[model samples]
Target: MAFEGIWNVVMPMGRSRELVRFSKTDLLSSLQIPSERHLLVAGLETKNDYFEGIPWIVIQHNLDVIRNITISTGPRTESVTKAVDLYLEQIKVRGNKTLSDY
Candidate 1:
């Protein structure tokens, strides 16, 4: 699979912020795995003139094994958590183990 593509996303989380950066084929071989659906979550620390804080969650998904990714923020609230909740709900309903589970 080719390794290319970038997506920047932002979601609302109370007064805080949820942001994400996605990339492809960056950490596959080291993990030693075949093509499959994958999701990753991480936290980011940042300091700037405007803000000084850490984005404490990130989530990423490999949509068919041909793509890789990185997500800098995931769910962080009760009212809403972006598309991840729907995705996880789908997985749960379908009885499929998520990437984190694997």
Candidate 2:
């Protein structure tokens, strides 16, 4: 048998969750990180006894990437522009990086 890896992000919603699957572009665009080199790191992958020792590589990678993004909006935003502005502001505060930072 061949080892076929599947990557995804499972979001917690109350007692349930949603599955999000994406490619490299999705991860990059979501984080607003222009460079893959900025996100990828050495020895970032992990292996567990999870499901018979298959490594949870994708989960680890997603966790790291998602940490740098605001995937959800706050309650008071009430508008797309405000939510977007907030995300942009967050990125600005974290570092002087934006859509044009590349």
Candidate 3:
């Protein structure tokens, strides 16, 4: 299998959020994953006939409050929380134009 394994997704439901896990087959067959709220895709694990790996952490923010996000990979030097904190600073500097417009 080229892409076979489970995909764990964290999404919002009403007031709080929930983590939902989906099989690769199910996702591919249905071509659907929850998209009603903002998402944070981190730590993807994939397995096939040959090898198993965790290549990247993809972050997808679906709110108009912030428009941009960036991350660095390869050779971890600091704690994950610290890294995220630094990245969040970008949003503070950039300012929330989308919210202000409203």
Candidate 4:
């Protein structure tokens, strides 16, 4: 399957963890980087497996080209949710602050 589309994912690389926004093309490009050999070396079709292998928790917001959603696979569910929650909280705070400025 062609992994092409906008996806919201939490990718944990080593000790560092952060939410990543990726278009399928962007993901393919990342796989080209030498540092990301682990993902490319195996020629993995299921890219999410490298993160945490299992059925990922997917929340679909809309049926459009840009699927702005959160995805987490396997035992790392908690971490993914936490990261997404934090991101949402930040957006909420920023929205509130913007309203206050008005």
Candidate 5:
């Protein structure tokens, strides 16, 4: 199946024992990034799990596209912003390329 559209993303970072939840509506509401071209990556963090620095991933529904979303425990705003950028870049690189090129 083709992967497109917004998706809920959740990721953990560092050793913080907290869960970060992002709703699909929240992603649509964000003005900083265009929701139409973004795939949301959000999830809950459990106490028994470790983020391993790359706890969160915002990948498209399509297996061909793999985007990395990094969630930070210190300043949430900064981390989220960075994740957005990373997502966008991934989309551009993966989606914009031709299948035969790979």
Candidate 6:
């Protein structure tokens, strides 16, 4: 039995590759991992024994935001929060402009 794993995802604006774990969808013929945010970017999945994948349009995390918030008990929480905020801002400002007029 084979299992899905993380793959190198070239950051949109940066020249670095980030490893993101994604699963192959049997129904959608896509490699996507659902999230609370409205959207995300999915790169191509080439291990096509079962199905081929496509580069999906990025979107926002949807549903309950509070439930998605991580519950970590530590002093470094503030730093983590700041880092996440920065990432979100980067995505919001730079992520492929889905709605051109929006």
Tens digits of lDDT, candidate 5, 32-93 = 32332323222211011222112232322321332234445455445545554554465554
Quote each prediction's TM-score. Answer: 0.18, 0.23, 0.23, 0.23, 0.28, 0.20
lDDT string, candidate 6, 36-80, tens digits: 121221111212343232223222221122124442335343534
TM-score of 4: 0.23
Evaluated against the true structure, the overall lDDT of model 2 is 0.36
The candidate with the higher TM-score, 1 or 5, is 5
Q: Cα miss at 75, model 5 (Å)?
A: 0.9
Best candidate, lDDT: 5
Decide which is better by TM-score, 3 or 6.
3
Candidate 1, residues 1-102, lDDT tens digits: the string is 221132223345555555544334444443432322222211111122433222331122213221223222333332123233444443344234332331
TM-score of 5: 0.28
Give the TM-score (vs. native) of candidate 1. 0.18
- Against the reference, the lDDT scores of all candidates come to 0.29, 0.36, 0.30, 0.32, 0.37, 0.30
Give a tens-digit lDDT track for model 3, residues 32-60.
32321111212211222332222231223
lDDT of 2 by residue, 1-102 (tens): 001132344445555565545465676576554433323321121222222111333544434543454423333223323433444454334233332321
Residue 40 error, candidate 3, Å: 6.3
lDDT score, residue 7, model 6?
30
Q: What local lDDT does model 2 show for residue 51?
A: 25
Which residue window of length 10 is worst by lDDT in model 3?
36-45
Error of 4 at 53 (Å): 25
